[model samples]
Target chain A: MKIYFPNFFQALLLIVLFTGGSAAFANEKSFIDEIKGADAPFDNRSVKLVRPVTLETVLAKEEYQGGAFRVLARKQHIERYKCSSCHVPGKPVLVQQGFELTHGDVVINHGRKGNELSCIDCHNQEDRDYLEDKKGRKIDFDHSYQLCGQCHFRQKRDWLGGAHGKRVTNWAGDRVVYNCASCHNPHSPRFEKRFPATYSVPLN
Target chain B: MGFTKKDKAEKIIEDVLEKPSSRRTFLKGASIAMAAGSAALATGCMPSGDDSSSGEMQLRWQEYFKKHYRLMTQKEKDETVDRLERLAKIQDDIDVQIGTEPPIENVLYGYAFNISRCEGFMECVTACVKENNLDRKTNTQYIRIFEMEPGKLDPSTGDGQFYHKVPVENKFYMGVQCFHCENAPCIKACPTKATWREPDGIVVVDYNWCIGCRYCQAACPYFGRRFNWGKGEVPKEELTTKQHYLGNRKRPMGKMEKCTFCIQRTRKGRLPACVDACPTGSRVFGNLLDPDSEIRYVLKHKKVFRMKENIGTQPKFWYFID
Candidate 1:
């Protein structure tokens, strides 16, 4: 006991130094949170008080940059939306003059190079309007990405995480990205080789 | 190899006596002559009248002597931009807008090229030419998409002049542009303090400050810079009216210009023309600081490499394969 604790003031000093220093370090560590992805969802909480963008955040009072972004809706751009318009309820086939003219040319080359799929594989045979997943869950045309995610899950993961696809309009505010169907045709996905376009064409 | 006094005197005499000199020496001599002439003209050269012609002359006078874009304050920038707009209207009958938008905070821009996706369509080249007001007469292109075979990724082994159908079997495409290197040798090579990197990692050249020495062109390992051989003319109607002071604005002949990642567009939160125009979605651009940005995701999840990265250029531009 004597060897361990001779001077009371010295003991107090050591205790104060160790405990106080450790507490400060713990606080700093929690604040910084330098772990792999403490800010994975990227809420901007880890962002310290630095930029003038802080002022914009305070003024806008909204979702921070890179926090809330969405995939652009494809329903409006789709030529044959509300598939119920053509494929009426309980009608096996609408067999109209314009129907074949509009969509008769859609060739199935989607999975020709790999695990081949038929029309009924991804398309719901029961309902012509909706796309079904492997589990037969109906996915809206607007959210066809959900249908795509069912098979191409790797690409889906990257697309959802802000890679593998193009962003539209702007980069900063309300990041809107393109859906898979926007670039790749649902039926024929392969791109053909073509002559490169140029504005000047000076190299002729 | 050191220059002694005798050698220095001989070099100076050679520099002065050389009639048709090198591009660098010519620019230095011309600038000195212009300075002397301007000093003489500074005292009451113009007639004192508010005539429309006098007003035009006054604008020209200020423009000819305007300070470098970097040194100008916000008010000075606005004044210069205004003066330039007026001068374009009066001299060329072209309505133009020159902006001076500064770099945004926390927004370090980066670009990613998907080597697997690019079909060598040259659409980015077309878009860059139109968007950046490139010299149509000379067909000055800022972006070059090279058609390369599968072996080596080096551009020298690739062909940029392919006009045939793209995505030729067993061939891949790579793009080359001003990499906007963090340690840009072009910036160091510039004798005038004209070319410098913006805060957002874009290396920009102040056209007014450039003396047309072409040192930056020779200094770039990627052969990225373009020198204006002559005034590359664009039809007045074909001119892109919206311009940035240090970007796509009409450039006088003999100055240096290169890609600014479409600064006028990118600064406004829009994608660069090349990225937007790519049909294959091969070009990805976004803020490097944002972890959720597509560029950041590519940097994390993709197999990536940079051109001449071993030279310590530290280019923000990266090429990747899925």
Candidate 2:
């Protein structure tokens, strides 16, 4: 009994040390002060309590010296979307019959208003909108199928119809749905044809 | 008298030899389906080896790559075929054999029609949408049947891009859709393996799997596909909601979609609604494999051409000079 009692006490001591230590360590560490002394709200339930470092801060880090969010945004637009096809910013968004920028107008109006919410503000590394695969990753942007589900609910319906994305099921099985960004790059969405339809034959 | 009986036997043999089997019928129907339903069966079906006792098989992208339908492990493919059969039974009571075929390789399918032959009838476009179950609000048609000038190929060349008048003078009508290509750039641009080309050379989009990023739309040389900007309007009464899981399944908003060569209708043993709807027999569908088929004959002898042949996409859809 004496020998077993000492071993039991040791085991209890270790359990208390590990559990109590983790609990105390988890006691809301604040990093808002690290960045301009602002009080950033933390979700207690989540295991990821480390204060998020934004693109703004990542650029300020020693590793990312020349990374400017504004510049990156401009580059992505110029390189990816043929921005010149429509708006010159200072100029009006080009609009004609059949081709309208109505959707763009809504997004630009609601999504990007205050300078406070930049491009990366909603779409960044920590946005849990996609699966988090930071350091050891072969594929970048492991987006959750649900992330795009937040905005385009209707497409999600068509997706269920087997009309939109990659379908990985038997013809008769319960349909599996994919996320929006899987097939589309959210920045510049357009339909692509394999070949130019210059052959002007008409199907009556 | 015995010699005459031998001659009669000879005549019976000749009659049996002369009789044609339903295989010819099957071939004719199959050919029509390939072109019309290229979009629908882009993934679901391939011809398999004759195993009368067994049923159809489902194939994954990887398994599809390893074997043509005939060479596939029957156990694996049957699991899928059985599921499809069950689904078909649920949808309808007809004896539907989801037959398998060898994986179609390298060959691409495309179409080019003579606008001169087309009237103002929007049969082809309407047929495609109804056959594919497009969102009613968007009224999505994979092929855009446009009314253009007789001499001009581009619809946007001369007139105000949108004209309210119906059947304007000297205007030629053209149907433009995905030119199922051997090399599809849109497939390359997708971050996920959502949209891709099948072995038989059809570019198909998985509506359910699409992320609605629109990169594929931008990558395409022809703006054949469209995006669901909103929940497409479907009049509840008019919705022919029978969904083909891979074919004209209803599309959702934000995802990119395009014409899939009437995949749903063609995959089954039937003519595409567009083909059936055409008042003029302008569309010709046939098996490239069969030398005697009409399409094969046209391709071999006629001056067949496709859109953007210069890009080397090797489109299966073609147009003979009007």
Per-model B-chain TM-score: 0.85, 0.63
Quote the B-chain TM-score, candidate 1: 0.85
Candidate 1 clashing pairs, residues 3+ apart or interchain:
none
Q: Per-residue lDDT of B36-74 in model 1, one digit per residue for the tens?
A: 565456534756553455566667666776666766789
Q: Each candidate's lDDT (Cα)? A: 0.75, 0.46
Q: What is the C-alpha lDDT profile of model 2 across A68-159, one tens digit per residue?
A: 11101122222324334443446553346214543333232223447333343334333322232223222223333233444565544323
Docking class of 2: incorrect
| Local error of candidate 1 at residue B37 (angstroms) | 14
Q: Stretches of candidate 2 above 4 Å error?
A: A1-204, B1-110, B158-169
DockQ score, prediction 1: 0.20
DockQ of candidate 2 compared with the true complex: 0.01
Superposed Cα deviation of residue B98, candidate 2 (Å): 12
| Candidate 1 stretches greater than 4 Å from native | A1-67, A94-101, A113-116, A199-204, B1-52
